[model samples]
Target chain A: MHAFYSPQLTISCREVQLPASESRHALQVLRLGVGDRILLLNGHGIRAEAVLDAVDNRRHSTTTCRILQADAAPQPQPHITLFIAPPKSKNIDAVIRTATELGAAAIVPVLCRFGVAKPDLDTIAHWTKTVIAAAKQSHNPWFPEIKAPAAFADVLEAADDHGFFGAVPEPADALPSPAALPVDDQRQTSLWIGPEGGFAPEELSALLAKGLQPLTVGQWILRVETAVPALLAVVLDRCQPHQRETAE
Target chain B: MHAFYSPQLTISCREVQLPASESRHALQVLRLGVGDRILLLNGHGIRAEAVLDAVDNRRHSTTTCRILQADAAPQPQPHITLFIAPPKSKNIDAVIRTATELGAAAIVPVLCRFGVAKPDLDTIAHWTKTVIAAAKQSHNPWFPEIKAPAAFADVLEAADDHGFFGAVPEPADALPSPAALPVDDQRQTSLWIGPEGGFAPEELSALLAKGLQPLTVGQWILRVETAVPALLAVVLDRCQPHQRETAE
Candidate 1:
């Protein structure tokens, strides 16, 4: 079913207007007309089946829908907050979108010493849109809270005991054992991924000082976009081993 | 350090010529000079440190490098072969690239009942480039074998008992249990993911009849690109829980 983002959607509301962008997409791109049924997402936990009721065509058109039914799903557990240095331009979008699809509870773009991209307000805004589209596409009920790009120092200040960073395994060193991770816990967990060149020594030291442990998926050094989903999958698996078997 | 793909690289080879594409990339894009040091990957398991010795700048310039030292890594275990019905144009590149980065042993493009994008020779050629580039970018010593797109029935016939397909779980059904998967085995494993609409019912039945199991990685219906890496990570984690702790 076609889906649209309607932040104000609620079960009690009889009618709702799709967000301006969503409305334009529905009319111009999807060519959805009145009387068509579509899914409305609130970026919260609301999923409402709504039928297009009115289309006011002018210089700026608006599409309104009547809600038939709505359901709220409790957010998934082990809320994961990802703190990552924004990768280069080509990868930033995929990174954000995939992280959302993987159900990251929040995403914090960090400006690191070795990082390439310094995301601006516009970049953040674009990422917000990417998150919304990803949520609708993946049918994720809960949208991740997207934070403004923060400095590395600021990120370290916010780091807590529940935080961990993806470590590149050393050849002579032992592999990161699964026992090192806290499993079967629903507490909010944080994952910090460094820039392409990786976090500087002082940055690593700072993260470690803040009680962030190191976790490694495997031997191969993966690009930022590749690492995000891979690491998230592993961490999520560890967080709720048995809960993911059934459909949400 | 800059890296290049040299398919014929071996430990005994004293000198090697960079492939035409690599030569152009090193010269035009990367701007590496005659004395620059680089790492050469054979796409098998050979990793060699080499120094550029000569730059034959003719119509098609060829770069010759002197092999300094070489090290060979054994191929990673639980070799995963991905049989995927290609997604739309935008996502296909990411799917192939991320699968290679996740250390898929081979990738087979399958034409499914609900699948879009019937890939031709040109697309296959482009995907081969994508795999090679991903291998080099991810610093993966081993390259995944890329095969020509095949029909669904042909893929089903080639699939073994070790195969599993991602199932969209029913809300009321019990979640997929980890115990259902065969863990800690080094044998080759196969993962088949359908197109955006997923496999038709009869196609699923055919797979089931062929002894392919259904595996669910949580409830979120992921995009093909996102699902590829997420499922690969989970399966790889299960394959050798302890083996991935250290770097190769």
Candidate 2:
């Protein structure tokens, strides 16, 4: 079934009108019309089943649907929040989309010593579309909240709960491995990834001083795009085994 | 250090001449001259440290280096071979790059009922560049072998060793979850990912009948690019805890 993001959707509402962009997509691209059943997401926990009730195709088209049933999915366990230093290119969009698909709780763009991207309010608004599209494609009810870009030091100061960063495999490293981080399903997990050249020595020291452990995936140096998904997948898998089994 | 792919590199060689492409990149892009040290990879297991000895920048530029030291990196443990149905778009290139970075043993593009890409000799040659580029960037000494495209049944018949495919989460599913797959670091591992929309019912049944187990990352349906890296990172982490610890 086709899915549309309706942030204002509430279980109490019987009728819903899709946003202008989504309405255009439904009518022109998907060719959806009256009487068609579709899924509606509130970008939180609510996923509602709805049937199209009206299609007002005028200068600015609108499509309204009648709610049939709304199911609220529990937030994913070991909720993951990604604090990443956005790359200097469009790869940040790919990173955001993948993070949403994998069910991250939030995304924070950090400005690091080597980082080049200076994301603003406009950037957050632009990335919000990418998150919604990925959630819709992956059929995920929850959307990751994108926050305003912050300084690296500010991110470190604000970080809370068991956090880990991808450590470049270097000899003489004394930091604890990811396996050493106790997996507590009840606690929120935070992942910090640096820019292309990775975190500087002082930045690393600051993170370690803040008690964030280091994790290594292999010997190779993975780019931000690859490292984010890889680390997110592994960390999420390890942290939520019990929840997954219970769901099964 | 700048790295170049020299498929024929051997430890026994005292001097080596780079391929035309590598020479052009080193001379023009990197602006390297005599006395500069670089790394050379054979795409199998050999990585050599070399110093530039001669630069013949005539009509056809040539770069020769004196081998300083050559080390053979042991192949990644729990050798992973990704037998994937190539997606219709450029995402296949991304898949190959990620697989190479994570140290897969080989990549075999399989033809399935829903698969759209018909990879020919030209396609294989094109993908090889992506593998080399990723390996060079990631500093991975080992490059995965890219084989000719094969039919779905042929892949099943030729498959040997413990295998797992990502299972779509569905109701009334009797298939075993990924956790059920026992970890054996000594065995070669194979992963099969279907194209967009997933495999047909018969294709899934055939895989199950052949004793291939199913793995699940999460409830969301991940695209091939995201799914491949996610599954690879998780499975590789689970399968080779011993090796990682030993390396550390």
**Top DockQ: which candidate number?**
2
Model 1, runs deviating above 4 Å: A58-60, A169-180, A243-248, B58-60, B169-180, B184-186, B243-248
DockQ of predictions, in order shown: 0.45, 0.50
Local accuracy of candidate 1 as per-residue lDDT tens digits, B1-248? 88899987997999999999899999888888889999899999999999999986663369999999999988887789999998887799988888888888899999998898899999988898998898888788888888889999987886766867877655674433344354433467888898886788888888778767777664577878778888788777656645233211
- Residue B223 displacement (Å), model 2: 1.0
TM-score of 2: 0.94
Model 2, A37-59: lDDT tens per residue?
A: 99999999889999989887663
Best by lDDT: 2
Native interface contact recovery, all models: 0.47, 0.54
| lDDT score for candidate 1 against the true structure | 0.80
* lDDT to native, each model: 0.80, 0.83
Q: Which numbered prediction scores highest in TM-score against the true structure?
A: 2
lDDT of 1 at A7: 90
